[model samples]
Target: MNALKNEADNKKTIAIIQTTRIGDLLQTSHAVKLLKENHPEYRVVLVARKKFATPIMFLLEKVFDKVVTIEHKTAMFGADNVREALSKLKKQLKEINEQNIDVSINLAFSKSATYLHSLIESSNKVGPYFNDLHERVITDRWSQYLYSTVMRGDLNPFNLVDLFSSIIGTTKKLTHLSNKDYSSEKKTNLLIHPFASNEKKMWKANRWVEVIYQTLKKNENVKVYICGSNQDQKSADEILNSELIRPFKDRVNLWIGLDLKELYSKVDSSFLFVGHDSMIGNLLSFKNIKTLTISLGTVRPHETTPYALDNYNLAPKTECAPCFPKDECTEFKCHNDVPYNITHQCIGQLLNNNKINIEELNSSCSSLSLSRVKLYHSDMLDNGDLYIRESLHKDQDAKEVMRNFYHIAWTSIFTEINTSMDIPSFNIQTKAQLSSQSKGIETLYELSEFGKKYSRYIIEEISKNTPSLEEIRKFSAKLDEIDRLSDLVSTSYPLLAPVIDFAKVAKNNLQGNNLVKLSEAAFYTYNEISLMCSVLYEFFEKCSLINKSKPEARENI
Candidate 1:
């Protein structure tokens, strides 16, 4: 037992910790199934919160060999029952530790999850865990990438499912939910989950009224089913009270009473699920039910769109969209941005065969309506990971343009999996933004070079016959100044936020403990950052110069 303590390579058991909500668990399930399929020898264990895990234990039981749950509410018994809670937590951790876990991955980046991770005995760890000094540390590259880019902003290009797959050290295989035959069914039931966990992500009931009315009016044999939690009774009343829905009252079914498992079982392929960015949509996606997600404030569609083929997503073109939760919002102009007509059209098309009429929708919809929203159809890549393609690219914005580059950059930089990533065609405004942002890239390069210089100095000093600790500390302090200066560059050019964010994570999760080893690790990180700068600079320059009469500019970047 003593010799095998740190033998991570010998063990085949891996523990995945996902203590978040239902949607996150669904996404994790999608990624892990691929890992299980490819390496059936590995025994997968799960660590999740009791509250979240209880809802979907029926599904979790099939995927994982052992499921250990943390009783969060019990653990927070305040001053009254703290000892009892502590005893339970210790028992839970001891149970997990005895499983002989080789790898313990914390996909849920909550503070509680990090605390739990520190106690679990794993030969190797991935994702965030508090070290002995009580400082949060994430050693793996993919987890570091996730920590840096996700939740920061619209800068993240890859979907959550894709990122999870990357972190699990396995690519998602091209195994989608099996195709279900819905043609035999005469009536097509459309499941609409209009409410989200947060208010910012959902549309008002009145707007949904227009959508339901139009959908029932234009399409025959189509029923609209509404589902939400019991807490959403008041909001559901608002939607149900609409006069527009009066004629189609017979077709609209509200099944708020059904638990998650019941809802999952009841909704089949014949039912098309349309809603805001919510768990109902994500849960249904596992069964390969078609989903139409309308992402609003604080929801980045690129990251959280339903995981499957032929699904759809709609998000506003509002500049402050996918805004931070802390931001002020008197009126959700982003909600108003998606007109009912566009949504009705989308529902009709997908109802037919789970395909959006890109050309027809673009040619038919009013220019004013087109100007308000951006439409994307979700599809998976060769490796079975999901991606969304803009169906209507007539008004592709600058932010979308940069997202494309970073999609290529991040995938290549982290995974070393180079894509045949093409350069996006730019509009006048995008070209202007690109030109200005390139200068920020220059500043980034300068800062990165200085970082490399300091790292080198630290390494050189540590290599001396009689190394001076004070001299080494001075060089390390200079590197800290350089890292601080990098924030300024991102401030001036928000487009370079991902670049700065990634570098910060890379430096924080540096390899080695001693000054000699640590200094060399810092040098390699800065060196990599410098290389990333070169790649991004080349992309920016190529974009600006693409207008020239050169065929080479048209080639894959």
Candidate 2:
């Protein structure tokens, strides 16, 4: 406590580590700004990727006292590159260490970020880091929540900005200059960004044409500025050169390959910003511009939509709306389901002097059989102004959906463990009927015993100077038995069906001759099965103690 006091008295230096892409890095700026705004005495520093940092250095300079760039790509590649990067990294680390940073916060939940967090010396550290044992450790509750339940789970309602704010111990919502404050000149253009990191997130080129054509028809004077990276030029050309849109090319302006400052300038001057889920969308939201974001592919609109009252997100209604990696989509139904007419209507409403009646549009659009589209905007005040709606669907609160998902997941895990403990023991029966009745119980008992035996074998194999292929084959055979038993158990207990899938994935990974990967897979499978058995055993022990205490309870009765 005294040391912390002394550091504070001597003007502490706080470093924030965010080596992620531009969108995520921009989200962290709010937290960084709050840290400086609330504590003028503390020196705030930003450590970011060299490629991503240079483009946003001007904006970063406003919030942070200094910006430190790490050449992560070079540091992680070829031998010559590694040598040069290490030499530069040594000098950078030396300077950072000399600052005697009082607090260090790692905002990225990646392996590289974890390793970097381990290297930084600080009086206090928060977020994920790698331990000496090479294990990943998330030091804060919020970060752990993000990793375990929020990242892949459907029920997380808080936005990444909200999570970032919690990590830095601030409640300040992101504040940016209003569009009016930045640009007093007449806003005559609507900016459109039609590309994302992946094709799945992109609306079809024809859809872009429809939106632009509709917007121009509603207001002929408003010009459309199409914005994107240099890599996106081909796709941008496709949208602009489409036979349907070519006639209106005179009014469309291509703002390709613009730097961040230049892009910000265009966004500020535009009457409305329209795009899919991307960094620029978020950047526009950060600047408090009125934005219309279309959510397609794996984007969870509730989590990633830009933060602003006027910002609206349009998402398709699908069971697998936010599927990740997105490589599995043979037909991207989610993207196809979003009607371009809805986007056209949204743009028309924003550009029109009088707001279009939403109820009338909803009634009219309902007849078109377009997949149900919902508009979402930030609502909750405490959660860094979290996004919310009356309902994602009829009678379903979006927040409650996420909460219920978490509830069901935890309940399923607990039920499996508790049920495994209460399973009755089966004695061998000579009668066919009795044996048939006990089949499910017998299978579960066999699986439990096999799990223990397999775990012990793995331990023994790992202890050997060099375990032979024969031993590995034996372990694989045991895994096969577990899979068979799991299938039989799932017939009676449907909840245990995932166990079969888990075993199959482990087995598939073990097939290749990579000894290191095989060993890790074996250890991981063994540990998982062992944990299930251990929990069941603990429950069994507790049941025995309760039965033993029954005599005392009977006497009292």
Candidate 3:
């Protein structure tokens, strides 16, 4: 299952193990491009699932010097006996092992991938891999950030590509698209993919039918390409055969059951792309083609939106949106939360190569209608990473303001970068919320000081000739209480929970061989949180200087 393109002539190889779905494979490409660009002499290899990598061979061939794929289903199920299967797997792995991989990075976040990471032969390993205790351990800061913030909840501020590039040790956070692909040479074709990985993540065919019917009617020069896989043939037919779409038969192209490379060609011929939260949106991202993603069900628009500039995302403001897969929901209300009218409006603007403006959207959409969904555009963050910036919201609310504070705290603590301060105008309610945050921050900061004090006590006692175990235990118990109290503070504020959780995880994964070294590591852990709290407290102090005005509530970031 090891598919080698042009061989690397005795160059050091860097293997990227990303054994996930098609979307993740596409996400990995962004980082691979940066790695190769930074170290062109180093041969970059990709370790992906056989099924996911094969379909995108046309794309992967251009990015990776060599692709090592895992065909576990064939090796396990195709074999006649257990011994034969074992032989088959070992044969595939032996080829991978012989590559003498200089660095093996695991972008795939799974137990199986973690186990596989341990098997790869490399002088250095990054991302998560199994330790001697068979427990998953991540040592790199970026991977640790991914484990703490991203793997836990939707509050993570960085895009997946940004995290991947950081994990690969790349210096710049560059966008993948060049101006050459986004030129006016493209035809007036629009690519629309309505299918998702599961029913929970997409809308019904009738909803897309209405959007397509309106789009074709408004733009007579544009043709629509309904894009999907072979499995979506039945669903694609339902949209194409709708009575509303019958009049636009000449303007519509049904692209299904074709090679993935063929789909890339279709993208070249298209001027814009509109789709649900699916792989096609990620695939279309390689090009700068304007995209409008209607994220429904469990999709966190901020996390999964295409990592290209000028991309737009629309998700329901529904409280239950971006729910977990395990949550039982027969209602599927998030789908209905986004009306098709706004979708068509955004497409109309993007198709004409018009930048979406707040006034432009306000001219056509109602306030109540707009309130149900939020429109965001992919823009560069202060650290050069990609993030969803609110395009239509008019002001920063309490939650948005808190997110900005956390952004500063995380940016200050994890990286050496300092973020530009963004002081949002506050309403009376938001001012009250800020007052609450001030209290919460003070409490949390005090608790972090206690953590540092306890760890310092342990370090001090350990330095003595006759260290009392009871005193060490007493301080340790006090430190444990401080952590529990910090967790309780998050329940009141809710916004500060992620950092506290991350601090806990870091303490649990503290490195060192003995108590002295371990206690120092623990002290560093608390010191970082203490620094984060200090940074946040400075922001609140800065906010105190912003002129507070009483006015009608407005939305913005």
lDDT of 3 by residue, 428-536 (tens): 7777776776666667777777777888899999899999999999988988898888888888977677778788778877778899888888888888877777776
Candidate 1 C-alpha error for residue 466, in Å: 3.4
lDDT of 1: 0.78
Candidate with best TM-score: 1
The TM-score of predicted model 2 comes to: 0.69
Q: Per-residue alpha-carbon lDDT of model 1 for 211-265, expressed as tens digits? A: 9888899887898889988988888877877888887788888887678889888
Candidate 1 wrongly placed segments (more than 4 Å): 1-11, 172-174, 177-187, 468-474, 545-557
C-alpha lDDT values of all predictions: 0.78, 0.63, 0.78
Stretches > 4 Å off in candidate 3: 1-12, 76-81, 173-181, 184-187, 425-435, 545-557
* TM-scores vs. true structure, each candidate: 0.92, 0.69, 0.91
lDDT of 2 by residue, 427-506 (tens): 22212222232333334545645654664666567678997768867876776677676667756643233333434343
Give me candidate 3's TM-score against the actual structure: 0.91
